[model samples]
Target: MFSTILVPIDLAEPESSHRALDAAFHMAHEYNSDVHVMTVVPDFGMSIVGGYFPEGFEQKALDGTRQRLDEYLEGAVPDNVDVKGHVAHGSIYEEILRVAKEVGADVIVMASHRPAMRDYLIGPNAARVVRHATQSVLVVRD
Candidate 1:
């Protein structure tokens, strides 16, 4: 029985998260839980990389991502569901974990893509979250 369900999705590839979202919704409906949908805007990682972009680009990116997250949930989430949206800027998995802790999420439901050779080397966000998160994680395959 979950009190809060956190779902992290990539807005650029929302289709991948459909299964995960559905699972989260089902759980939320069953337990009368709150659903928190979150999206992360990856940071440049270095100040030099940030310099390549124009001024105010970071703020614009965050603002745009927030707007997109809102618009996305408007159609994706059911009217009956109690849902909240979060837009974070940083390492994808870290942001997700931070939000999960911040929101006191009981579990995290997320999508995982088929692993490519590169994923083995660097690992995927879902994998990282599963390894690092203190909360229970359910990874729904895309």
Candidate 2:
């Protein structure tokens, strides 16, 4: 059983996040674990690229994500479980791993729209985590 699990939510795909969150919440309940929900922004990429975007771009993006997560959590997350939402700036997979480490997650719970050839190779964010993460992973398919 997992003591800590990380669930990465794509704000843009808020509607689809429920399935992932639900699965994570179920697992968390089974193990009495905490769920760490996160959304990754592309700001880290822009900063690394060393360029300024239009005014309010970053804030707008962050705000949008906050709205998405808030909207999704209205009736999703459980009261008995611990849930934390974070907004990070960087690659989704990398940020996911970083948060998993920071939260000391024993298992990483996530979702994938589909698996293609790319996934068979380097794979998606979930796949990458499965390959690199020292802990276990539970990937929900949609």
Candidate 3:
């Protein structure tokens, strides 16, 4: 019985998270749980990378991501489901974990794509979240 479900999705590749979102919704409906959907805006990896962009670019990106997250939930989430949206900046897995703790999520439902050789070398965000999260995680394959 999950009372709070947190789903982290990549808006750029929303199709990747469809199954996970559906699974979270199903669980939410079953347990009358609140759903927290989140997306992360990755920071420019280096200070030089930041210098390449104009001032306030990060803020603009964050604002735009928040808007997109809200629009995504408006269309995807059912009216009956109690859902909240979060937009974060920084490492995807870290932001997800932070939000999960912030929201007191009981479980996290997220999507994982088929592994590629590169993923084996450098783990994907889902793998990182699975390994690091304090909460239970259910990874839906895409």
Candidate 4:
């Protein structure tokens, strides 16, 4: 039985995210596992985009995202499940895998949206995570 489950969500996509969270919650209940819910913030440190935002934008974004994650958990997470929220910066797929390893997740549960042309060329974060993750992954399709 799994001891820890990770669910990575995109806050912009509520429907798919909730579906993935539900899957994680179900598994957590069955296995008595702790749930790690994470969302990645794009790294804006690159020279081009960095100039656009004013100073402290990264900290502000992180604070807002952390609040949103906490609010989401209050409503969505079950009372009995042990849940922790994490906010990471940089490439989504890489941060997810890094967090999964850091937290020692036994399985990763995440959603996959309908693929667009760009996904074929670059692949979606879900696909990349699936390919790179050492732990088991459950892709909940939307």
Candidate 5:
């Protein structure tokens, strides 16, 4: 049982995270806990100093992510269940950890959708968080 459950989502592959969300919800419902669902947009830093996006590109991504999260909650999160949605820009592991501490989360539930190239070298973000986080982590491996 947990007081707060953190569910991390990858906007590109939403389906991959369904299982993790289910687990988080199950635990939340059973314990009457709060759920904090979050997604981190990888910072596509500017090409050089004093560089900026092409006319609202950054806002477009943020807006899109928020809208998508809204739609996802409308479809996936039950109406009676209380959940908070967060969209942030940063390194995935760091953002997740920050949210966890900010909320004083008892546990974090996330999904792993197979490894790509970079994961093999430095390990996946989830792996890093599991090793580093002060609270508990439940990584739902596909």
Candidate 6:
């Protein structure tokens, strides 16, 4: 049984994320748990990329992502579900794992795409999360 559930999605590509979110909600409902819907914005860690953007880009990005996440969940999650939205900036998998720990999530439900050679080389976020997560992770393929 889970107390807190973490559902991570890619806002840019939410093709199959809905499936994972639905599953998480179902589980949360069954267990009387709260769902934490989270998404990560890629950090402009490199100085070169940071220089290309204007000042306060990171804050702007976080704010924009927060708004988008709210809008996204408005239609995606049902009103009855006890849900919270979170935005993080950094590596996708790392942020997800961090949020899971931060929220004391007992389970993480996420979506994954079909593997390609490039994905195997660099590894996908879902794969990384599966490997690194301290709690249970259910990966639903897109």
Instruction: Please give the CA lDDT of all the candidate structures.
Output: 0.94, 0.80, 0.92, 0.92, 0.86, 0.91
TM-score each candidate: 0.98, 0.83, 0.96, 0.95, 0.89, 0.95
The local lDDT score (0 to 100) that residue 111 gets in candidate 5 is 91
> Any runs in candidate 5 off by more than 4 Å, and if so which?
45-52, 115-118
lDDT of 6 at 46: 79
Model 6 residue 142 lDDT? Answer: 74
lDDT of 2 by residue, 9-118 (tens): 87677656878898898888888887889888865454655455676777888888787777667677767777888888777788788888998999887777787876
Question: What does candidate 6's lDDT look like per residue over 31-79, in tens digits?
Answer: 9998999999988777798998899988998999999999999989888
Lowest lDDT block of 10, candidate 5 = 44-53
Clashes of each: 0, 1, 0, 0, 0, 0
User: Sort by lDDT, best first: what order?
Assistant: 1, 4, 3, 6, 5, 2
TM-score of 2: 0.83
lDDT for model 1, please.
Answer: 0.94
What residue pairs clash in candidate 6, if any at all?
Answer: none
User: lDDT per residue, candidate 3, 1-142, as tens digits?
Assistant: 8999999999988887778899999999899899999999998878898998999999999999998888888888777887888888998899999999999999999999899999999999999999999999999997
Better of 3 and 4 by lDDT: 4
Say which candidate scores most in lDDT.
Answer: 1
- TM-score for model 1? 0.98
If both were scored by TM-score, which would come out higher, candidate 1 or candidate 2?
A: 1
**TM-score: model 3 vs. ground truth:** 0.96
Q: Residue pairs in steric clash, candidate 3?
A: none
- Local accuracy of candidate 4 as per-residue lDDT tens digits, 28-94: 8888898999999989757789879899988999999999988988888878888999999899999
What's the residue-level lDDT of 70 in candidate 1?
Answer: 91
lDDT of 1 by residue, 64-85 (tens): 9999989989989888887899
Clashing pairs in 4: none
Q: After superposition, how far is residue 122 of candidate 6 from its true place, in Å?
A: 1.1
Tell me the lDDT of model 6 at 45. Answer: 73
Off by over 4 Å in 2: 44-52, 118-122
C-alpha-based local distance difference test score of model 2: 0.80
